[model samples]
Target: AYFKEKGKEVIYDAEHFFDGYKSNHAYAMRTLQAAAQGGADCLVLCDTNGGTFPFDIFKVVQEVKKNFGIKIGIHTHNDCGMAAANAIMAVEAGAGQVQGTYTGFGERCGNANLSTIIPNLQIKQHYICIPENQLVNLTKTARKISEIANVTLNERDPYVGNCAFAHKGGMHIDGVCKASSSFEHINPERVGNKRRFLMSEVSGRKTILDKIQEINPSVTKDS
Candidate 1:
């Protein structure tokens, strides 16, 4: 009420919300009700410890959205390596907003990875979080953020990671050679990344044949 009277929009962050909800369901809800009464424009449920499971997040967020008429948001930490999953679950349960770090850096383990969450929502689920053209710069932005933070970009990070679309194994390379979709979830270029074919003994003959054929279209497997 104070903020609202002063012409301010308050986005209330319910810290340790999942933990509180698990420990005391009624009290946790009472706290949110109080925040609503106090004129919070949006209620952001936070998994402070990052210990909550995705299933629990989904269930609780669903309940919160069902009971409240206000806008809902989610903030999850990556302590359990489930932040992205938990955030996605919350969205599936009807939360309209998600909070995360661009490069997944934060206190302790880290925060939910926006790099992972955005693509998951936009490319796979058909949700639009940003301008379609901006989405293509995801990998570039992630790399830039990592550089500014002086942290080496995680090569295995989904969508923007170096190895996220790399293929090295023989069968895998063959499948990718036949059709990129055979081995990749989506085009790496979608996020401003690229396909990488690692040259190694284990890459198999089919991979070599594909490469040779790229230069010499008449090349045959028997030859």
Candidate 2:
């Protein structure tokens, strides 16, 4: 009431929402109701412990949307290694916004990874969140944030990882070399990354062919 003297919009975050909903569904719904009645502009459901699965997150968010007419948001952590997955699923179930960090950096594992989420939503899912040009700088942006935070970037991190598009297996190498989309789900270049073929026992001739060409574009298969 005091803060809203100027008609400022307020958001109410229901922390530990999954746990609270599980413990007492009525109380959790009531909390959201109270916030809406009190003029909250948005209601964010937090996965405080970060243990809820993506399916559960989707279900709970669906329920919240069904019952409340206010804008719905979601906050997730990576304790179960599903923060990104859960966030995506929640959006699928009608969440308006997803709260996350650059490299999923935060307390108790970390938050959802916007690095992974942004591209997935914009490029793959075709959701309009940011400018199209913003997608091109995702990889460099992730690395920069990681550097600023003094955290080693995960090579296997989706979309922006060094190894996200690396192919090693003989079959995979052959397939990707023939057609990149065969073995890769998304174009690495779409997220400012390039495809890589790691030299290994399983590497195929095509792998060497591609690498040789990368090193010296003039080199041909006959040579």
Q: How well is each residue in 1-223 modelled by candidate 2, as lDDT tens digits?
A: 4446678978888999999999999998999998888888889999989999999999999999998898999999999989999999999999998899987889989899999888888877889878988788899999999899889999999989999998889799888867888989988887898988789998777778877898899988798
Q: How many backbone clashes does candidate 1 have?
A: 1
Candidate 2: segments with Cα more than 4 A from true spot: 212-218
lDDT computed for candidate 1? 0.93
Considering summed lDDT, which 10 consecutive residues are worst modelled in model 2? 1-10
Angstrom error of the Cα, residue 160, model 1: value is 0.3
Residue 132, model 2: Cα distance from true site in angstroms? 1.5
lDDT of 2 at 120: 81
Candidate lDDT values, in order: 0.93, 0.89
Candidate 2 lDDT score at position 63: 90
Error of 1 at 48 (Å): 0.3
What TM-score does candidate 1 get on C-alpha atoms?
Answer: 0.92
